[model samples]
Target chain A: MKTIFTRRFPASVKIIAIVVLSLLLVLSSDSLAPARQYLSTFFSPLQVIASAPLEALDNVSETVKSRETLMAENQKLRQLELSISDRLLKLEHLEQENSRLRAMLGSPVVTTQRKLIARIQSVDTDPFRLQVVLNKGIKDDVFIGQPVVDEHGVVGQVVEVNEFSSRVLLIADNSHAIPLRNQRNDVRLIGLGRGDVHQMELQYVTKNTDVKIGDMLVTSGLGDRFPEGYPVASVTGIENRGNEIYSTIRIRPIAQLDRIRYVLLLWPELATSDASAPEVLSQ
Target chain B: MRRSPFFTFLIIWLSILCAALLQILPLPPLVDEYFRPQWMLLTAMYWALALPNRFGIGSAWIAGLILDVLWGTTLGFNGVMFGLCAAFMVENNHKLRTYSVWHQSLILLGLVLVYQMLFGTLSSWLDDALVTNSYYASSFITLLAWPWIFFTLRKVRRRLFLS
Candidate 1:
């Protein structure tokens, strides 16, 4: 057997053998996961270098912005801040009252997990898949399956993590589906990506289901991958047809997925998780 | 003067690196879908054809592996595709060398079409992707990129051998 193995085949034949073996290895199991992680770490610098030209262009565009627009933005923000602080006062009071009620009822208080802000470096907007490379990873305690969100709502979960960067499989990928509950009716359904930037469709809803256009959908925390009560998408259209068993419901993602720049990484599993870094940015 | 093989290999990898950069370079929202060429594949194919004895299927397989990581696919998905193309180029090197660059590009158009269909079907089956007819736009765009990449690589290889 050793003598037969040592006998060399032609180069093409050898390459064919190796390629088929490696492809099978990858397809059958995740034994190469560690190797892929290290390779991705080694490749991260190249990824950053590839994205530099776009970054430079963005910088140039940022510098030439008008002062008038900045001032107008600042003026609008001051009013928003004022209104938010007023709401915060009421929220603080309500939180105290709710906690007291919870204590009396012998319930556990909700714990706030530390979060870190990650900047998106590059995006893979393929017809088959949707993904983005974030400029944060294992060193920053970003674990696989970590929930990611933008300022407005849930963006995606961390799918691949390297030493210095990780890849996020966005909710808009055709292969991706998220558990969600309608905010108004509270009916639970799964949202499936239609491989488009702006649309996701609901699954397993009957024709008689109560759904209306403009109804908001939030993550139900059913799978525990996404935190509870964060906005995911809002219903854009709904169609009921007798031929189909399920009504066609479309929802537009709340986060501006097309122009996403920054996202927040959440620490969902607090104590048992290896994400114990203390210097994280609070969400 | 005997040129160091290491330097030539470096030059080859650098060229492929530039191709990888072009692969990820973002464009305008409207044009991006139609314009991204298979830069890495084209560069590897040029070398596999021009220097089959040296580049061979091995380098192309490695290039595909890197692309798999870069494109975030399962490890050997692109490695298989690229390996197949590089092996084909090596086998057809003599017949291909008789043609002009434009003629070679016409051949590339056919290869790109087949590659695209196979890729689409495989991805849809494995990754559950819902693909449409519009993905074909990039194949023609890939054909358009071939001449520029071929000439540039040819010039570089000549410069390396001369010194």
Candidate 2:
């Protein structure tokens, strides 16, 4: 037994032992749970440190580049402003008539929930994961699972919140699904993330469905996670066959997935009433 | 007595931090998806091949754990891969040391390929086909990075350890 112990063990045996022992160590490290959150929080300082140079570069270049872009955009906006002023005058007259009609009909006015604005500090560096780290977190009343939006449309929702920063999972990630309704036909479906930035898949739409290319899809607000009526995507293609049970519906997301510096995190306000309350409340 | 153990440990930890920093740096869109240079694995592979006495499987696993956290990956994913890579490199260090730098470059390319393949397979299995490209592109990029990385680290090792 002693001689055998003195002899070298087989390399395969050593490999197995190494794997087993590593697994055991990982299992025994009971502190890894909080350590992960701590590491993410602690290492964000490093990301900020690393991103400072790039951010400085951006600021320097942006001032020079924006002069040319703003000049061209300003000319375009002048033409648009002339056209919109005429439309706005007509719209004001129509709105007055519509309000009189609404008063006679005894209908109430609808108000939207107020939005809290936040800035994008940095994006998650992982390629597989689609998440962004925002500058506002729990300290700013940012809660997990709150919807996020930019000027174009809905972008994503907050998933994890630290004291100073929150992680927002974009709509393009695999774990997220947004309930949507086709604006043209009111057909409801769920849009699942396809792991690509610009694309999402509409699931559970049957082959006989009437969804087509260029159909606009909006949030259904079934889960109350995202507010209803916000534009989500436009269907780019729809494949339906008699033999297949489901249609392959592709959509291009309305939000600019790659180019947002600021966004709003929307927290839905719940209404509580003692005896009788108004029809809606916005927070 | 020539190399204090604590100092070596500090260097290893610093190297791992450098690796994480490299991972976090913004990459161009064209090369972003296909190439994730295994910075920690490369560092461990270097130390195990050149100074086997100073670092080993345990060091590799710890670096892997740190990488897993930094990259927001499942626990033990990189840890196991790093452990296996380190163990293999150490076991073959003698033969690896005997090779010329050119031959070593090719062998190191193969090692990088293996390491990437392990990561690709493990991550795809965990998340259901999240990883693609199968290391073909990463292998090319890693091969390109090998000579410069090897020479630089070798110069550092010589200056720090050999006098």
Candidate 3:
């Protein structure tokens, strides 16, 4: 053993050693969480420096937009704001009525989700993993498994958090899956990302299920990872093979997965309080 | 070879730092998704070929770890691929340096393809992420960019050491 240690290993032996070591590291990734977090914090300032030029370019382009286009955009936004305000008034009344009905039925009250807005610091360039680093983290009460959304809809979830930065696994990543229900029919299904920025797959939906093109899917909240009723995706294609038991339902995620510049992190209010509550009361 | 050890180490680290920065710089979505070259890999390959004794398997492993942290990949995924790439280059450094630039580029294409294949397969298996055909397009771009990186680094080495 002493002689072997003193002798220089051949290149092939060295390569095999590295391969074995790395495989071990991969198998024990959970143990490396602290290291990953510390490194993420250390790299946060460098990421800011690297992203500075891109931010400046974005600002310049925003400022240089033509007056006509700006005016049209402003007009469109004003109309949208007015409509949203109208809906908000009606929504408030509906919420009050919903609470009254729930009280009469002796059901638990719905809790509002707490949210924090975070700027996207950088996107993972690896074509395989769809992830983004956000500029908020544990210091800001960010935690793993927090549901992330943009103005449009559900963006992804926080996978790793450090002192000042966190990584979001986008809904379009192949490994990510969300519990979704058809907004129109209330049929629950699992939405799985297909690794495309524009697509997701709804798994195990039977052919006879009342799903159609353009049916909006929202979080069912069955998995407890995401809050209920957040828009997730919309059905785009349904391939119902006569011989197959389940139909292949494709969807387009409502959130602009690739174009997101900012996302809102949601902290579910019930998750904390309901843990101590009786199971029946919590339900 | 005559340069001070500190100076040599500083140059190597500075080059690696610049490559890391370039790796993370945001480009437009289309270009970023399809055209982004593997800057760190290219830099490691350049140094490993130029000075095999100085920058070998260990250097490549460090570079890969840096990339893993920056890209938020599993810690040692890039390390394995990078160490293997560097080892292959170091074993054949003498023959590789003697080849023409085009031939060297062809060899780089092969190396990068293997790197991507290994990375993609492991990621897909371990992380369950899908790898598309366009992910391999960057290897071609990396091949195209090799001569430029080679000439630029060679000039830097000549100016800093030979002069």
Best by TM-score: 1
User: What's the candidate order when arranged by decreasing lDDT?
Assistant: 3, 1, 2
The reply for model 2, stretches above 4 Å from the true place, is: A1-33, A65-114, A121-124, A271-283, B33-36
Best-to-worst ranking by TM-score: 1, 3, 2
Candidate 3's DockQ: 0.53
The stretch of ten residues in a row with the least summed lDDT in candidate 3 chain B is B1-10
TM-score of chain A taken by itself, candidate 1: 0.84
- DockQ of candidate model 2: 0.39
Indicate the worst ten consecutive residues by lDDT in candidate 2 chain B.
B127-136
lDDT digits (tens) for residues B1-163 of candidate 3: 5776567778987898788898888887778766777888988999988877667787798889888888888889999999999988888888999999889988998999999999999898898978888788767887677888889889988889821
lDDT of 1 by residue, B17-92 (tens): 8888778776775576778778888999998887775576778888988888888887776777788888788778
lDDT of 1 at A220: 87
Worst 10 residues of 2 chain A by lDDT: A273-282
- Across A20-82, the per-residue lDDT of candidate 1 in tens digits comes to 865685686377777889999998888888788888888988888899988998999999999
| Best-matching candidate per DockQ | 3
Each model's RMSD to truth, in Å?
Answer: 4.4, 6.4, 5.2
lDDT of 1: 0.80
Residue pairs in clash, model 3: none
- Candidate 1 ranges with C-alpha deviation above 4 Å: A1-8, A96-112, A123-127, A269-283
